[model samples]
Target chain A: MQLSNRLIKWLISGPPLVFLLIFFVAPSLIMIVTSFRLPGEFGGLAPLTIFSEHTSIDSGLTLETYQFFLSDWIYLEIFLKSFFIATLTTIICIAMAYPLALLIANSPRKFRNLMIMLVVLPFASNFLIRVYAWMIILGPESTLSHVINHILGVLGLEPVTLLFSPFAVLIGMVYVHLPFMILPLYTNLEKHDPILLDAAQDLGANRWQQFWCVTWPLSLPGIFSGSALVFIPVLGMFAIPDILGGTGDIMIGNLIKDQFLGTRDWPFGSTLSIMLTIAVLGATVFFTWLARSVMRSP
Target chain B: MKEIADIPEKTMRHSSPLLRLIAMLVYAFLYIPLCIVIVFSFNDSKLNAEWVGFTLHWYQTLWHDHEMLLAVRNSLFIACCASTSATILGTMAGLAIHRYKLKVLPILAFTPLAMPEILLGVSLLLFYLQVLNLTLGLLSIILAHTTFCIGFVAIIVRARLQGMDESIFEAARDLGATPWQAFYHVTLPLIKPAIIAGALMSFTLSIDDFVITFFTKGIGEPILPIQIYTMIKVAVTPEVNAISTLLMLLTLTLIILASRFDSSMLRDPSR
Candidate 1:
């Protein structure tokens, strides 16, 4: 019986473990190794051995990609810009999602499920469709642009193009990522005990003070998680920037994508991916630490 | 329930007018774009700028487009294949994590869920081309989709398992039933709803996937999302809106069905 049970354990776990190992683990390891190697004559990695080539060129693993990334300021600038955009997007999502989440949380229990479903429904649409919606809204010929530009024209100001700009990119990011923010915040806020708020109010605390002293502090975990979801995805997002962003609005995602698909520099692409992985993991750790410390301090 | 019922009506009406207004605006922000897409799909205009008149011209164009049809076929095929495999493997992974003290399986199952979609896309791209030396097409795409989708299914199934009454399983064990027999007669039936939900979720995810599909797809086949991407990047037309509306309807149906099968599963925070 014990032997059969053990066999059953392997039966249940082995397939997925093997599948993920082959597809997920092996590929990730390959990406790390590819980052160290040199670019090939065409696109992929260069030959590891000198015997494959007539000329004796430095081939097998090297730190050249990392060195190149360090030597150039543009790559660093792109990283900074991606971070800035992700930060701004996360902040905006918080501001927009907080009140909405609060409302859903505070709603009658029967309606809460329906409300949360509504929040998630838009996300059922394709990601590109969500981004493309912004393209239509922000296009110069669209009503939004025409209205805004008309108002500006009346005020003797130059008409600003809305379709392919940093502003448009930000809107697309916020639009697509808003649900991620709302869900986590709603989940967190829904669990808050109403009795605590009542006690705070009875103690002569105003609404704002009650929120600050009670609700806000209680909801920090949700906020942190929501921020991570929005920030991390935005950091690595390429589609929004690719479709809606102007030439000047390139984020790290675009730079990495360009290396793989456009420029065909596999090694460089792998390097950018590694950097992005580090950035994402680093941000996750820092925010977790910050959340811990902040929670501990109070 | 009693505590919530005991909360004063005054506190229950905590929504200020200002808060209501902001929340309404946020809801609009969530919905207006999608509303416009569905609305514009029927628009009788090339530019999608205005509601000139109601027409199904773009839908007709989409229906007749062989490339679009082919892409739809490929996406359906991939979604079906990928979701099936993911459902099987993920159910096992979920059951294992719930039943055992395994460490690596849990991380392996869930890490893909947290990582960016593009990372999975690129890594698999390199793996297929360089390591497997496999031709990139529907097969590569199916593998890639399955790899990422296992996490989603596992999460759903695990949540379902966590909610289940364990005493029943123990009772079955004590009844002199063999391990496989107990699993077949007991656990399988109990987690069926979760398995269905996971399958539907995987289907929607696989069909809607663009980034990973973009990397793994070869030049030969026209996958739906990639085709839509090309059309959008190259030009803006009502046809794209038409396709978007239809695709939205498809996924919306799948999501609604998944929620119906296991309502609590969809709302799981750990998802």
Candidate 2:
């Protein structure tokens, strides 16, 4: 794909480019401008109008807005919360996915696709809906807890609180993002030759060692992609915390949304957003580098 | 990486049960909530967990709710419209870039996909709210959706387009056909799977979209997931369960139907 000058090609590409340029890029540029807004003395956002509001143009352009986020302990805590949730979600996803992926790959063809579909179908809805599903299912006296406790009561232990805790958030995070993990692992694991497994067992290696030495390493490409896919979104998820965590489990995403949509603090929100984006990009780069090094191993 | 492979019978003594336990527990973790949602949708009571008796009242309630119908209508309309537009544009972009050797367009085209859904939503919100001074509504949502939908279409279409044997198009052109005729006679037929696949992928992504729509939707009721999010703020109701159950089924049905359309032989109308 070399860059070439062609009238017809440009014309063909013109519509989508123009549409995105006007709507997507333009609005984004405008938001960046808005993100720089300084708050007025009355705690209202100083509007960024070029016309009437421009009479006091000097009133705009302040670093105080961004500084607010840099100083706020609550915002920083929420940012760390987002990271923790995403990391926990990634670990759980890999732990579960590696096994399920292996089983599905070894299963018969018809069931394999069906299993994959079952895993991914849950993802086909707005991700928020699945979070809502968890809220209902995880609440104290919730059906799931009730059932589990009813069984545990056979041993006389009390019912437990699984909802509205970090544990609940973790469950929702892992549940919703597991498919991202499974699909990648399955893609890599499926390419695996079964004869390798037969050969390993013939060599007298146990199931655990075989996985540690071979399957895990072979599946790293998938593991990397899937983990990144899960972790990146989970890092900024607002809805899961809002519903399942209720008042307590607020994450950095909620804080950013609060800044722009709630508090009208554009600068602080933008700063936080920039930070979050950088964190994701950095982590993805690190993992990709790790994967590359593993790939080049002798 | 390794030469050795198969497992020994003696090794199974310690680990097989542990793996089975882990798999069972994880699957339970995944589906038990879904099962509860299905069950409560049939509950008689207002409170979700409190099942007074089996009742279809929630389904009745959802059907009668005008706001729910409007949300459904708007969501379906936007999803359908956006995917159709994205599919055509994506197919063109795929063909143009692959066939005509376009440069820099590749990276610029997909940069939109790299942006998080939240940022995309907020940026579009600002565009519609401040710059354009347009009210939040279905139109804005569709516009927002199609932006991301383009990436999906481009990926699938490019995949299909690349899979074709380039010689077929060459032969058609060499046989005295015009570029349009060569494309129509050879290339179009070849890449139809990717086009169809991309279109379906685009549609599902749009249909299931929440992040972008959350920012762009201006008016009442919003989409189903947004409504569900708000409902979670109140109390979890059997009615919400019923709605989710219906949506889950609808999504599954659409997927099943889309899978049936994966025929590679689109040009041969006889096939």
Candidate 3:
């Protein structure tokens, strides 16, 4: 019986475990290993002979790639810019999503699901195509811009370029990621009980106090999870910036893509990817700690 | 009593008008871009500068675009393969984790979800090209998608399994049935809806995936999003809009269907 039970467990779990090992873990290991190898003539890792030669001499590894990234002020600036944009996107999403989530949660039961569906429906569409839609709307000659420019002309102001600008990139990032923020916030808010608000009110609390003492405190988990969801993905997003951002709007994701695809520099690309992963993991840990401490306080 | 009961309602009515306006604007921000895409699909303009008139010219052009159609076919093919494989593997893992209480299974299952897509893409690309020497095409894409998609499927199935009552299997065993018989007869039927929902969700995600597919899909044929990316890079045309509208409609239908299955599973308590 014991043997059969063990057999069944292995039967059930073995395939997925093996699959992940081969496809996911192995690839990640390869990426990390390749990051340390010296760059070759054509931009990928050096030849197998060189790798074998280096295996004998300190595992044939070098710190050049890491050194390059660490020493470069430009790469640091790009990472900082990505971090700033991600922070901005998260803040804006929270500001927009909180009230909306509150309203939806407070709505009558029959309308609640419909409202939630409306929020989620756009997320079903292609992400790239949605960015394209923004391109059309924000294009200089499109109807939206035409209307804006006409108003500006009437007001004796100069027409402004909208597409391929940093502002357009920011708008695209927020739009693409808003659903990520809203879903978690809505989930957390929907569980809120109205009786708590009434209880706070009866305890001599006014509206602002009721919200601060009741609702805001209750929704911290949502804010944490939602911010993580939005911020991390936005930090590493390539497509939005690729489609909507100008030359000055380059982020780390674009830099990684250029290294891999354009420059064909696999080692440097892997290094950047590793840096991004570490940064994201660090942020996640910090946020998790922050959430715990905040929840523990008062 | 009536006056006292009216207090909460009165307080609800005191919710600010500015809040409602912001809510409306948020919805507009969420939806107007998609609506614009659909609208421009029917626009008669070539450059999409101004709407000349309502026409289906772009749709007609999309029909004749063999490369785009081929990409769509390839996407559908890959999505079907990836989702099915991921669902099977995920369901097995979910069942195992639920039954055995494995210590590391949960963390392993969720790693894909927590990892960034760009990292997944680059790593998988490197693995295929350098370690495995595998060609980058439909096969590579299917593998990469299935790896991440398995996480989603496993998470969903595990949730369903957790909500399920374990007594049914016990009852079956108590009735002189073998473990396999009990699982096949009782547990399988109960988790069928979850499996279907996971499969549909996987399909949707696979079809919409761009970053991972972009890295792993080597030169044979592009998926729909890849084709759309190339087209937009060269020029913006209404034909791309028409195809996008079609993809959106398809995805929305699948989402609605998937949600129906999900809600129905939640509603039914017997399983």
Native interface contacts retained, candidate 2: 0.37
**Highest lDDT scorer:** 1
List candidate 1 segments past 4 Å from native.
Answer: A50-59, B1-5, B268-270
lDDT of 2 by residue, A82-123 (tens): 888788899988988877777766555556666666666556
TM-score of 1: 0.97
Question: Best-fitting candidate, measured by TM-score?
Answer: 1
User: What DockQ does predicted model 2 obtain?
Assistant: 0.35
Instruction: Compute DockQ for each candidate against the true complex.
Output: 0.73, 0.35, 0.49
* Predicted candidate 1 versus true structure: per-residue lDDT over B24-123, tens digit per residue: 9999988998899899999998987889999999999998999999999999999999999999999999999999999999999888888788998999
Q: Supply candidate 1's per-residue lDDT for A54.
A: 59
RMSD of each: 1.9, 5.0, 3.3
The Cα error of candidate 3 at residue A27, in Å, is 0.6
Residues B33-81, candidate 2, lDDT per residue (tens digit)?
A: 6777888899887776666898889999999988887778877888899
Docking class of 2: acceptable
What's the true lDDT of residue B59 in model 2?
95
Write the residue-wise lDDT of candidate 1 on A1-298 in tens digits. Answer: 7887788899989999999999999999999988998999888878787557656665477999999999999999999999999999999999999999999889888888899988888988899899999989999899999999999999999999998899999999999988889999989999888878889989999988998999998899888988998999999999999999999999988998999999899989999999999999998997788678777986
Which tens-of-lDDT digit does each residue in A136-215 have in candidate 3? 99988888888889999999999988899989999999998888888888778777767778788779898889888888
lDDT of 3 by residue, B26-134 (tens): 9999888888889889998887677779999999999999998899999999999999999999898888888987876666677878766888899999999998899
Instruction: Write down the lDDT that model 1 would get.
Output: 0.91
